[model samples]
Target: MRLALAQLEIESAAVEDNRERAEAAVAEAADRGADLVALPEIFNVGYFAFDAYQRAAEPVEGPTLSRIADAAREHGIGVLAGSIVEDLAETESVETPADEGLANTSVLFDRDGRRLAVYRKHHLFGYESAEARMLVPGESLGVAEFEGATVGMTTCYDLRFPELYRDIAAEGADLILVPSAWPYPRVEHWQLLPRARAVENQLFVAAINGSGEFDDAELLGRSTVYDPWGTTLAGTGDDPDLVVTDVDLDRVAAVREEFPAWRDRRL
Candidate 1:
């Protein structure tokens, strides 16, 4: 499949403008013949725009995602609609006792504008951030099928947890999409973890991150795609980019069979 990494340059609290930017990027990706387009995390309100979280939070079926779903249908391409600060109450399915707080949620839209899966971020960052205190941690894992690949979704901080990836892998996922808002000074970690997960699991990994600076932090926009062999297929610098590349879904099984790493795993 040909994938487009929409490394958006998110603006702080500029919801309407950022939505427009993402729409245009989706169009560009379609024009470039990408079968699927994955966006950066929190591209709508900017990840570090902590104050805007409460105000910008919307329901799962809110206008922001509706617009993106329309774009995906119009372009006849599947889309990983980055992520949004979601008011869980808006989507009754996600509501829980912690519905009093918000959830960092990601949605997947098929080419026909169908909502396939919704994944709230499982790991909330606690290192000098309000996420842990403000948002409810997600409790479930989500996986779907797209273009002959079993796809799964995860957010930025979740990449640091191998058990989560292993769970998805055990469920027969071949390609995992990570929407991120990774910041500067941790570029090495950003580069290392995704490739490590891909090589160890023998599955394709696509990590899409945002660009631009917020009041409290700056994003490192190295959106990347790694093959099952841990080879870097496509990557961007620290800037807004549409990193597009093709990946063979068949390679996942080939690599797993040839490497035998999965066969060596022990409890």
Candidate 2:
């Protein structure tokens, strides 16, 4: 499968501008022959924009995801609508983690614009941030069958937890998409975690981060895709970019068979 990771230029609290850029990226990726395109976390509202979280929060089927679903259908390519600040109370279409609160959420759409999965971020960042206090944690894992592969979704801070990836791997996931808003100074961690998850889980791990700056933080772009063998197939520096790469779905099984480390897990 051909995958495109969109490292978008996100501006704090600029909902309309961010959404436009995300849609444009999807169109460009489709034109570039991508079968699927994944976006960064909170592409609609910048992740560091804590004050705007409440105002920008929308339901799973709201305007942001609705436009993304339309773009997927128009382009005839699958899309992982990176993520948004979801207003759980207003969302009646899906089962929310909380009845009346905000959550970090992502939605997946097929080429026909069908809602395939909704993944609220399981892990909320707490270190020097307001995300944990402002959002409700996701209670379920997001996995779906798309094209010829099983895809899983996770957010930024979730990369630090390998157990989540292992659980998804147990669910027969072949590829995992990480929608992140990772910042500067921790470039090494951003680089290490996703590759490790790919190697240990014997699956593709694509870490998609955004670009641009906020008042207190600046997004460190560096969106990357790793094969089952932990090889960097495609990547970019700290800038808005479209990182596309072809991945063989069969590689997951081949790597697992060769290493057999996943099967030996006693814990």
| C-alpha positional error of residue 22 in candidate 2 after TM-score superposition, expressed in Å | 0.6
TM-score of each: 0.97, 0.99
lDDT of 1 by residue, 159-238 (tens): 99999999999999989999999998898999999999998889999999999898878999999999998899999899
Candidate 2 RMSD computed on C-alpha atoms after optimal superposition onto the true structure: 0.7
Give the Å error, residue 151, model 2: 0.3
**Pairs with steric clashes in candidate 1:** none
**Candidate 2 overall lDDT versus native:** 0.95
Ten-residue stretch with the least lDDT total in model 2: 92-101
Runs of candidate 1 exceeding 4 Å displacement: 93-98
For candidate 2, the TM-score is: 0.99
Ten contiguous residues with the weakest lDDT in model 1: 91-100
Best model per lDDT: 2
**Candidate 1's error at 143, in angstroms?**
0.6
Number of residue pairs clashing in candidate 2, backbone atoms closer than 3 angstroms, sequence gap of 3 or more or interchain: 0
